[model samples]
Every structure is written in structure tokens, then in C-alpha cells.
Target chain A: MKKYSDRDSLLIFIVLIFFFILFIKLMYLQIILHVKIDRVVKKMVTKNNIENSKRGDILDIKGNILATSVKQYIIFLDSKIIKDLNKIKMILFKYGIKIKEQKITEFKEKSYIPIAYNVNIDIANKIRSQKLEGVGFDVRYTRHHPEGKFLTHILGITDCCGNGLEGIEKKYNKYLLGSKIVTRMYRDGYGHIIMQDKLVDQSKMCGQNVILSIDRNIQFIAEQELRKAFDKYNAKKAICIIQNPKNGGILAMVSLPDFDFSNRIKNLKILRNSAISDVYEPGSTFKIVTIAAALDMGKIKCSDSFYLENGKLKLGGHIIRDNHKINGTVSLSKIMEISSNIGIIKIAQKLVKKEFYDYIKKFGFHSLTGIDLIGESKGILMNLKYWNHLTLPTISFGQGIAVTPIQMLSAFSIIANDGVFKKPYVVQEIRKVNNKITFNILDNQKLGKRVVSYETAQIIKKLLRNVVESGTGKNAKVNGYSVAGKTGTAQKFDHKTKSYSTKFYTVSFCGMLPVINPKLVILVIIDEPKSNNYYAAAVAAPVFANIAKRTAEYLGIKKDKYEIV
Target chain B: MYKYFLLIILIILSIFIYLWQQNTSIRFAYKVSNLQTKYNKISIENDLLKLKINSLLALEKMYSIADRNGLMRPDGNNVVYLN
Candidate 1:
């Protein structure tokens, strides 16, 4: 009996050892293979919870929000998991959403179903509260331009996906879309967060804010005057750019026939910013380069007299006529004051072709002005090899070459900045979304490159002042400001006749107020006005005067030319 | 008996620590999530107010309002400047 009991005990011991090994193997699978198996199971039940981070804001120098992002929601359908389709449809109907039966069946298997986006929080929360199966909620941010149509061309617009398609918005898109993250959360068959990662700073995902050098008051004044001229003249296009000549800061820039950011674009032509993209003949305003070059090189003197050819000079089978007729020889300064094209062309004839070409390029023409905006055009200048006998004479009077208004403004800015060329920029600082200014223009202290001798710039300024005070630019003078500027009226090129058209003209005026220690440099262009008066003096000068006057008053600029009673 | 007593104490302490850590992490997560919700609300409010301010300061809107109110520009004779 004892032997029989021992045999039974041995069998029982072997069975016990087998059970113990099985238990150890099960524990190993649960602990060691846990993460790998959990991921696979989680894929079936887990969904990514994305935090729709806000895009950065764009503000004026004074921290006035021009462009911002608002919190919104995106409601998507999950037809696969939907329990009560009719009930879900009824709940979403009040929030401007409808799910067609056929459409739901068509995408019945799809886990991710998009229904409506940009829904406000109040409505979104109401829909989310129903907690109906298959209905999902996602946070989204919508871009807002608070100033409406103002600064449209500068602020630009975004695509449906919130990507900046144009202007400053497009330029700083990367910085604005900061660190939007998608996190994994596990839930049961019913959508609920079982386990989730830690909450992060949602604001950190927002893009950095861009602060522009544009002044709201100054931009308003410029836009108001430019719009008035644009409407009154029935002009095809109008552009006005205001710059801080001391530091190459663009204060105000307006291009008319402009589209509103709030409205969908119907015509693509309105998207083109004429100030930096469209090229036009600079007319007599380009004479500054000729005079400055000659004076700088000691090739032409201020007192040097030139025969005016009795107001007309025949060159290369083309007659170049001066609008203001002057008899006999006139001093160089008188030639500039009268804007005698023939006299200036005669002076240009004295310099070598290469020297004249060198000076034209030296004045920031036929090249990008390096402004912060994109799609800048390098104005047309024919290579010296392509320059015919007439090219030099026409170019001397600003007829043959084409130049962008921003480039023209920068050239004038060089003179105002005491012959130093500082690159023009619209962005003044980059800040955090919370209005903390990070990168500042004032802190940069960028040194400017010398473009001309100070003596030459002073001479040109004096001549420009004479033009405004006693010459064609007299209309551009302010009541208590000593302004200096040049007037230009260049005929538009007609492709049909292959010659300059008489009917259409681009009248422009580039100038600055408080000539000595100048505060602002302004450029105004009116393209193809239908009015009887198409002269730069008549069409563009008055606009400059009004904008400068209002801007000076708003900025409280000192009146440097006041007379004592 | 002494060894068995030590083992029981160690196991209980370990289990207690594990439960405490899980409880603390989950509790702090809820707090963080609540704060995030409040922050998002404030940010939305800030943006909406800015939009309102911008509309009020809009140049065209202001001009139209001024015109409607029968405002007149001061003449040169009436205008004064502060030095």
C-alpha cells in the first residue's frame, strides 16, 4: 500500500511542475510582450487627438492687431460607429450641418468623415454634448483680418488650408505655424479618453507675431488720399508709398484697384502690388541720377551752362522736346529747375557711355530694391551692347528705361538719408503671439552703404527743394514745410503702334517733407488717368501734398519752414 | 518567520508607491487640461476684442460715421497748433 502511494505522489509532483511552468510563461507574455501587443490592439481603438494651434498674429508698430487667429471647431462624421443616425442628424441641423442618407451610406465604412469646419465653440459644444456614437469633434483655428480691406495687399490672404498665399502672411508662414502636435489617446468602442499624455502649452504651437513698421494713422491718410485720386481720376491704377528715409522703413504703401481680404478674389490683376512689381518709365524724375553722377565725378559743375537747342534736340531720327521752352544757354541748376530734357540730355552726352551706365546702376535702378515683400521686379535696363544711339538720350531723360516705384523711392531715400542706401523693409519686429517683441529693427542698428557723396546729395537736395519751391513741383509744397521733390510724366508704350502712346501717361511725384533733416519720403503714381489733365504736377503732386500734410499733422512733425510773425 | 515578514512589508510598500504615482499623474493631468481650456477661452476672447477694436478704427468706417454725423472740417482760420 505504501509503494502504491509513492508512485501516485510522483505523478502528482510532475503535474504540479507543469502547471507552475505554464503560469511563468503567461506572466512573461503579459510583462515582456506587453508594449508591442498593446500598440497593435490600440491601433483598433485609439485615435489621434490633434490640438489645432493658432497661427501667429500680425500687428502694426503700435501693437494693433491686423491679422489674427480665432478658435473654432471642425465636426466630422464616423458613419461606421454611428448608433442613431437620425438623432445625430437632428442634433447637427441646428448648427448648420446636414448628413444626407445616401452620402452617409456611401462613406459608411470610413472612420474619418468630414462634415463642417469653422463652427463656433457654442454650437460645437452643443453638438459634442449629445455624445452620439460616430460623431466626432476637433478644434480648429480660423484666420482673421480685423482691419478688413485695409492693408489687403500688404497683409495678404490665406488658402482654405490656412497657408498664406500672398504678402506678409505667406512670407512668415513657417514662424506662424509653430509646433502643432498630434497626440495618441486610447478609448473603448465608445469614444472616450482612457489614457492620454500630459497637457502641453497650446499657445506655444502658435506662430510668432510680425510687427510691421507701418503706422496706422499714416497708412490711413495715405490710403484715403490715394483712394480719392484713384476714384476722381478714373485711373487704371494708383500707388502711394511712404518711407522713413532715415532708416528705410516703409510707413505706408497702398495699391488701388485693390481687393479686400475678407472677399474672395475675382480678378487676379488686383493681386499685383504695382508699387513693387509693375515697371514704368520714370520720366524726368530719373534726372537726379544724371545730375548726381556728373556732380560726383567732377565731370559736370552746378554753374556749367548748356545750350538748350531752343527747347528741341533732334537725335537718332527722333525729336526730343522740352515742355518748358528756354532760350539761350542755361546753368545746370536752371536746367534741373525747368526740367529741360534736351539740356539734361546735352549734359549726358558729355559723359562716356560706360560712365553713364555705371551711374544709372549706382542709383539702385535695374535691380531689386531688396524690400521685405516678394516678387520684386528688377526694372528693365538694356545691356550697353543693345543700346542704340537713341537709348542713351532717352534714358538720360527717364524715357527708355522702366523702373518700379519702390526702387524709385529707395533712390530718393538715399538722397534723403544723406547719400547712404539703406534697404527698405516693411517688417519692424517679430514677436511672440502674446505681444512680446522679440527681434526689433531699433536693436539691429544696420549700417547703410554709401551710394553718393554727401556734397552731391546736398546739391541735389537743394536743386529738388528749388523745384518744389519755385518749379514744377510747387503744387507739392505744404503750408509750413520746406518740401523737395521731382515731377514725372512719361507716355505709356503702345504695343499696337510700337511707339509711345500720347493718350495714356503715368504721372508720378517722388518727394520728402522738411527737406533738411527730412522725416518722410513719399512717392505717388497715377497710371493712365482718363482726365484732360495728365501731367504729374496736376495729377500726382496734389495727392502727395494731401498725404504729406495729413501725415505731418498726425505725427506732430515740426514745421521747419515757419516764418516769424 | 522574520524573512516572510520583511517580504510582506516590501511588497505592500511597492504596491502602495505604484498606486500613488498613477493617482498623482492622472490628477495633475486633469488640472492641466482644465487650465488649457481656460487659456483657450481667454485667447479667443482676446482675438474677438481685437477684431472689434480694428473695425471701430477702420478708416472708411470712421469716415462714413463722421460724414453721417454732420461733422465739418475746421477752416484754416479756426485751426490751431501746439508748439
Candidate 2:
């Protein structure tokens, strides 16, 4: 009986000891480890969701959509529960989606796996309908150009990550790429943004929409005419710009050879916007700069006479000859009308070197035009101290100096704008998602800087008008519009020959309509024309005429001449 | 003693109602979460469709099609001014 009692006591003591150990473990788990366990549970239940803000839309002045973003989905899978991997592959393959078979299978335990990216909405819908248990989708944005291949260089292309890489896309990337948002959402086992709380403002995620001053119709017209000439001449490159003279708004800009932004580009050269990126000798088109400077400085006048030296001027051991020779004495108007190189050289000789350099700077040459485009090239200009005997006369005739297409257009626009230089820009306005103006450039402010007097600009305009009316720019003359312009045919410099190449030429035409009070300024340039005629009057003027005519008609520009009073 | 037994039963009934209400609230929250997800997806789909429509109606595409069909733009002489 004593041994039985002792055994019972021992058993009781062992049972109590086991209960105490269990109680201690319960206390540790419920108190000390409680916070840690709660965190783990929350992490399992909550999803770290990243909602991408939609990139802003690019719209023309008329609210025409040029570029936009569409919601695309990346199809993913949880290989853990993929019942019948072959079945999933079969459905995906039906919709033209090809996925690597071995990758998902190898990572069978991965909760989230990417199957395909940028699956279009139509196919994504078809995929969601399948209701495959483990398959999932994550949303993303794909940049879409509504205008297709048109304005490729202007609107530029976004990379796979929806970041702008060139042109306006790069220039306004910060403004266009809205803020990305991250939300720790409490999702129900399956990962998703729990919208029940409505905590995140999706609208704040969107970048600002850019409203460009570009007129789509005008851009199309310029692109069409420029492309026609480019193909006809088999030119290496071509550029055209249409600007509003009154306010310096760039209405249309076309550069070719251009690439389709929607397609993957192989050659990066096609992405360059040549209108602002490339520089070439203005040739005869640069004569306007000489005239404007001469007239502005009271050094020369339309009525002033210059001895052509029989159309050949011997200066600095180099005999400079004119394209069209005029013997004896000729008026400044005649010099411009005939596009005589000697005549312009004689005029440039009248202005001092310092005066010439100052005028060039005033005309917005040798510096950026601030045209709201990236990669603007400041044309080559020699320092005044480096000017030799031949530099002045040579530069006067649009040789030995370089100017971009946009710079030459601005010079012409100053004359049309009553001698006031307005900074050229393409972006008219930038609005936030809520339609509030963030950056507004479409103000009524005119005359960014006074380049020359109104009287001097008028005299230059008159001479330019005569050049178009009955001069070398006759092909550029639009019917009943009173055009004013200059044509350029510059020899491209050959690095191999260390001089200008005879075979390669850059033909250009920069002009404005209704010279009396111009509204539009248009410029066209063709590089390395392989056609029989490489003259600016032949290759570039006709293109200018065609584009200007179409643009005027589209914009309802009134006929200034041949109207019955 | 019988009254106290009745009171205990009443208390048990009230506790059961309270628990049922809490359960209903949780179920409603789940429904709300699901509805929110569906709404977001639909909105995205709607935006995508709108973008597609705009692309299809782009002027450049229309012009290309018109050119293919031998349609030439009318000259300035043919266009009558309305204003």
C-alpha cells in the first residue's frame, strides 16, 4: 500500500510538470512573439501594389490626339497550383502568345511569375475569361501614337518602360511621366488593389497632358509635300517648318527620313529631328540676314547701288562669282531678285566686322533659338578676331557660315513679324490631370525681343517680295498671296576633300505669305539631292509652294492680291 | 431561481446576435473588396477601348486609306468658304 501511494504521487508530479511547461510556451507565444506573428500574418494578407500613373496625352492645338497611353496587362502565373501546365500553355498559344515551357515549371513554387508582357486588352480579356486558377495579371502602360508614323520625330518614342527617349518625349519627360504610387493594400489572399478604402488618388498618378501649338492638318501637308520631294530627289535628308509669324508658334515641323515610333527602331539616325538638330550653310537664303543687317544699320538701302565688278569680284586672291551675273551697277532689290553672290558680297563689305557679328547674334544665330526642342544645334560662327579678309564676303553670300533650318525660319519670321523676334515654341500648354494649367505658353505676349526696326523689316520684306514675284524664288510664289522669300543652294563641305563637294548640295527655301502683313512662315530644305536639278528653286521651292498652298487653304488665309475691289 | 435561469438565457441570446452582426460586417467587407477590384478592371478596359477608337479614327490613318483609294484633296478653287 505504501509503494502504490508513492507511485501515484510521482505520476501526479510528472503530470503537473508537463502542464507547467505547456503553459510557459503558451505565454511566450501569446505575449512575447505576438507582435512578430501579427506582422507575419499582415504580410501574408497584404500586397505591396504599385499602380503606374498613366502617361499624359500629347494633343495638337485643336485638341487632336497625337500620342497617348493604353492600359496593357502582363500575364503571370503561380506555378504552385498550375493544374495541367500543358493546358495553360495550350490556351496561351491559342491567342498567339508563346511562353517558355521550362521556366515556369522549374520555379514551381514561385507565387508570382511573369508569363507575357504587354498583352493587348482584347487578348487580356480573352485570357481572363479562361479563369485558370493560378494564372494572374498585372497592369502596365504601353505608349501609343494615334497618328501612326506621322510626326515620328516630333512626338518621339518611349522605351519599353514607358519613358520618353527623344524629341518632345524627352524634352518634357518629367512633365509627362506622372508620379508612380505604391500602396500597401490589404488584399484577400489573392493579390489586388483593395479599392474599398479609396485611399490612393489615381488621378494624382497621371502626368500632365501637353497641348502643342502644332496644327495636325498643317503638319500633314508639310510632311506630304516634303516626303514627295524627298522621294523624288532621293535626298539623304529633308526638313520643313511652318510657324506663325505673329506669335512665333511652330505650327508644323517635318523631318525625314523618320522612323515609325510604334515599331522597334534599328538605326538611331532616323530618330534625329533635323530641323533643329542639323546645321547647313544658308547659301542665298542667308542673303536676307545681310540685307536686314545692312538696312538696320543704315549702311545700305534698297535704293543704294553697288558695282558688281561684272558679276565677278576678285578679293583676297579668290575670284568670287555670282550664280546670276549683273554687269556694272545694280540696285539692292535687283541683287536679291537675281540672287547674285557678288552683289551680296559687295553689300556685306559696307558693314563693319563688329557690326556684322552683332547683327548675326541679334538674328539668333550662333546660339540656341530656345524653340522648346531638344538637341538644338548652335550653328558654327567664327570669332570676330578670327575673321580674315575672305570670311566677311564669303559669309555674306551664305557660305563659310552655318545656320539651322529653325534659325533661318526665325530670321524670316522677324521680318514678317514687323522686326520683332518671338521665341519659337511647339508646346502651347501643359495641363495637369485635373485640367489645371501647369505650364502655359500660349499667352498673348508678342515681340520676345526687337531684332530690327519696323521700317528696316518692311524694306527687307519688299525686296524679298520682289525676289518671289519675279526672281529666283519664282517657283515659291503662291497665287495671290504676295509671298516674300529667299532660295538657297549651298554646296556641302566634304571632309575628305577639305573643301565644298561639287556633287552634294543642300537646297532650301524660307519664306512667308502676304508679305505686307505676314501670318505664316514656311521653310523647306533638301539635303544631297540626286535628281538632275539640285537647285533650291527647283527641288525645294516647288515643295514650299505645294505645302504653303495647302496650309493657307486649310487655315482659311485670305488672298491678299488679285481680289476684285 | 427560475427567473435567474431566464435572465441567463436572454443574455446568451444577446451575445449570439452580437456575434452574428460582427460576422455580417466582415462578409460585407469582403464583398466590397471584390466589387472594388472588378470596378477598377472595368475602368481600365474602358480606357483601353477608348484609346483604340481614337487610334482608329486618327486623321493620318484615314488619309492613307483615302490616298490608296485614289482620292485627291480638293484644290483651293473647289473649296467654298462658309464664313
Candidate 3:
């Protein structure tokens, strides 16, 4: 202090200057970077949210709900905010929740931690009332199919984020799942957090509620009948489809063993829609298409007759035989009634192989039915270029080719609907949430193409009716209405053995009613029945009869012929 | 003159305080109203979802399906188990 030299004073001034610069820098940070720093700090303290919109409800035609969503809370813990670990543990234990030590240790370093998800409102309220600090709850919407086991393949399911995971849910996910909105907020001096006014328009964002063409009662009936057949025959799988032939509206489509929408599926294979997804050699059931094609081409008249080749006809290396081989010539109508394999082969030979192949293409075989569904299959049909002499003959008798249950039904629908084949659809309309405004009918434009003459269709229907009355399909005959349909017993091909497995059989029956003027067409399929009966008449015919009879009566379609048993 | 100046400053300060309080109360009232509306909306939505769930998962509906189809509860002897 005594040595007051000029240099010393200069040094002290220099130090003061340095100190002033540091002070300026501090002020700059506090004022200039205040907004950014505040944001970072708020991010550290504020609650984060993953936004979601209300999911749409799937409804039957009668306004019955099939699927909808409910808000479920995911309880979490902010490890940093939790003042006492013991307290959090106590609250968790009270709610029957357990926290492993490893989880707690792992999340101890994290600011936010998830403890449990999908807790119901009651438990969420109880947790909220505890008012424990650092405990957070995220309210999210979860999908729930109220009809847990009914229409599982159609209603489909969604993921935790409300994304459609399967079925119609997957097909129309975007239309069914509306838009989600997210907002950030922070507490003020009074602990009331004000929202930033970037209001999202959520009204138009939520998925529009869909109304399906399915009637709940009709679906129930179809499912019940299918299930009874499934259990009675000890069938490995079963499917039933009910449709309004006039507009190609699908009323009920059930496949078993169907999964409960509410339960976690152990095996996903069972979830497949067998009616549209799985293809089988249609067997005798496919004779309908071959006959329809033959009739449409005018290659053979309804009165056309063919010799049965004396019960055994050699076509290439294969021998074709009938179930009830009548060793004589039969009329075209009797050919259908007896299901003569040789008779169909003879008729198929009438068309040039190219014409026969083209007719098969026209009937939508080896092609999708364009139905409103997922996982549709176009069954295998070799092109005319690869057609061998045996190919045409075998295919004529409903073998050496594959077709889905839906394709067969749609083909028959063309005949039942008087030749105008309308594409099948499941969804009917979309409705708004706030108001009762229906948006639009699903695919309002009709896609119809005439595939057969009205006269040929009428003849085919009569021939089918006779099959139900006194032929192989007698089990499918209704009490009051004259039913027309065919029975199919197909042998499934074994991949490893490279031959057909007699142990595995696909039994199916497809039919329409009122013979002259059909209103509905029903198809039932039973796969791998183990009840010691492999015939379609024993396995699938009764199922079709029950579903058709009850369904026709339910629709209040009066019988044309009032006959008592 | 000193006394008059002091009185003017006091009047100005009092007016400013009154305005600030009024603005704060209005903002608080708006927040409460908004929150109340949100709560009401949530309640309505919750009710609607509940009704939909009930209608879809009704026992009568399931029973009708079972009855119409002829499905019955499996007997102990008929039930098969696969590993």
C-alpha cells in the first residue's frame, strides 16, 4: 500500500476492467439468453405428453357398437420428483402394483419413469387422490371391442397407440383413426399452467365412425350356426358368409376358432379370415362355376345330355368317378343332381380350351372378388398356355384348381342376382361424432358387370334347387323355401407327401333360396372335420341350412311354398 | 405545490394497481371457465365410450349368438388339450 507507483495503479485499473467485463457477460446471459434458458429449464421441469385423438366406433347396420375406445391412465414416476422412494413403493403396493429392485435401480438416474400402463379410471383416481409428488399419470385412449369374441376377424384390433393392427381396423386405419393433438404447458406463480394458443382443429381430425353393412342379429345367427357346426364336427376351422345378393352387401361373416378381441391371442394363425384368405380345391362346389361358364357360353343347353362313360372315364392318367356313379347317360339337369364328374368333363370339352379358360377368368376365378377385406387370395388357375388335356377335364370336375370360399359365393351371387355381379362390401356408411351427420356410404359407386344371361341364371337356380330337394344337398333344404345349392368334399394336398391327404378334408356347402327369385346366398365351409364324417353333406350342409333358414325368417321373407313336414 | 404533486402521483399509482388486479382476475376467470369446459367435455366423452362398450359387450348379444348357432359349454369329457 505504501508503494504507490504508476505501474501498480495501472495494474489495479487493468484488474478492475477485467472484473467489469465479467459482470457485463453475466448481465448479457441473464437478459439476452433469458428466453432460451427459460425454455430449457421449463423442459426439464414440465410434463411431456404424447397426444391422441378419440378413436372411432365400429357399428353394425342397426347402430350396435362393435368397437370403441376408452381413456386409460399410464401411471409413471418422476424419479427426481419423488421425494421418498419408500412412499412411492407404499402407494404402488397399495394398488397391487409391484416394482422390481432392478427396475427402480435402472430408472433411478432418469427424471421420468414408467411404472404401470392401462390402469382403469378407478385406480387412476385412487392414485391421483394420493397426491404424492413426482408421481405422474398420462391419460391415453385404448381401443376396446365390446363384442369381445363376436366378429373378431372383421372388427379387428388396434395397437397401444390406437393404430389399427388387423382386420378392417388395419384396412381403413387412416379413416378410422382421426388426428391427434399435442400441447405443452407449465405452471405459473399460482400453479395454474396456461396453454399456448396454438389450438389444433381436432373436430375434423378424429376418424369418422363407420357403420357396417353387418346386422348384429344376423351376424349372431351366422356365428352361432357356424360354431355349432364347428363343435359338432370337431372341425379344425369353420367359416360362414351371409350376403344380400342384390347389392353384394355382406351381412355376417364368421371364422372359427375366432379370437376374443379383448384377450391377447396366443396363435395368430387362427385370426385369419378363412372365407377370403384360404384357398381350397372347391371340389364339387366349384362345379357351379364350370356349369355357369358352360351355360353362359351357350355351349350346352339346359336339356343337354352326356353319357357318363359307364361310371369310369379315363382323362389323361387320371380316372374321374362320381359319388353316386349312374352307369348311364343323364340330362344336363340330372348331371347336376347326380354331380356326375364325367358329365361335367364332357360339357367342359365342348368349349375350345381357350374359351373355357376365358370363361373361368370371367367368373372371377384365380382372382380376388374385390370384397372389402384384407388378405384376399386369388386361387390358383393355370393359364390356357399351360393347360394340358387333363387340366381342362380335371378342372371341369372341380379339381386340379383352387378357389376361395368368397370367390365361390360371389360367383353364385352372380347367378342368384340374375347375372349382375356386384362387388361385395362390408362397410355401409360413415357418421360424424358431434352431429348425427353421415359422411358417405362406403364406395358409393357400384361396380357391376354382367357375367351370365338372366335365362341361364334362372335355369341354374332351378337345377340347384333340385339338388337340395332330392340330391346330395338335401340336408341344406329349408322347411318352407325351395333351396338351391351344391355340396363340396375336397381333399387337401399334402406338401411333404406330394399327394392328397385323405385324413384332411374340406367340406363346404353353398346355396341360395326361393329357387325362382333368390334374395340371399349363404356359404358354409368346414375344414378338417374329425367327427369320422368327411362328406360336405354331413359336415357343411346342415350348417348352411340352419343359418339360411333362421336368417331368411329373421329378415321376414315369406315363403313362396307353404308346405308342412 | 409539493402536496399536490404527491397527491397526483398517489392517484396514478392507485389507478394502475386497480387495472392490474382487474386484468389478473379476468384472466383467472377465463382459465377456470376453460378448464371447466374441458372437464365437461371429457365427462361426456367418457360417458359416451362407456355406453358404446356396454352395448357392444352385452351378454344378451353373445347369448343370442350362442343360442341361434347351437353352441354349448363344452363338457369336461369332450374338451381336448394340445401341448
Candidate 1 deviation (Cα RMSD) = 3.9
* Prediction 1 global C-alpha lDDT: 0.85
B-chain TM-score of model 2: 0.82
User: Candidate 1 regions off by >4 Å?
Assistant: A1-36, A41-52, A78-115, A130-135, A182-190, A433-438, A442-445, A563-565, B1-28, B72-83
Tens-digit lDDT track of model 3 for A280-338: 88888888777887888888888877898778888677777766667667898888887
- Candidate 2, residues A1-565, lDDT tens digits: the string is 4656878899999999999999999999999999999999988777676777889989999988889887888888887777777788889999987878687667668988887987877788888999987889877888877778888888988887789889888999999998887866666556553433445656678989999999988998898889999998999999999999888899999999999765778888888899998899989998888888998898886689988888677997889877666667988898988998888888898999999989999999999999898899999999999999999999998999999999999999999999999999999999998899988885644437999999999998999889888899999978757789999999999999999999999999999997878889999999999987789999999999898888888899888887323
Give the winner by lDDT. 2
User: TM-scores for chain B, in order?
Assistant: 0.76, 0.82, 0.66
Off by over 4 Å in 3: A1-50, A79-90, A96-113, A184-186, A195-204, A434-447, B1-18, B25-30, B33-45, B48-83
Candidate 3 DockQ category? incorrect
Deviation (Å) of A469 in candidate 3 = 1.1
User: DockQ of every model listed?
Assistant: 0.45, 0.50, 0.13
Candidate 3 global lDDT: 0.81
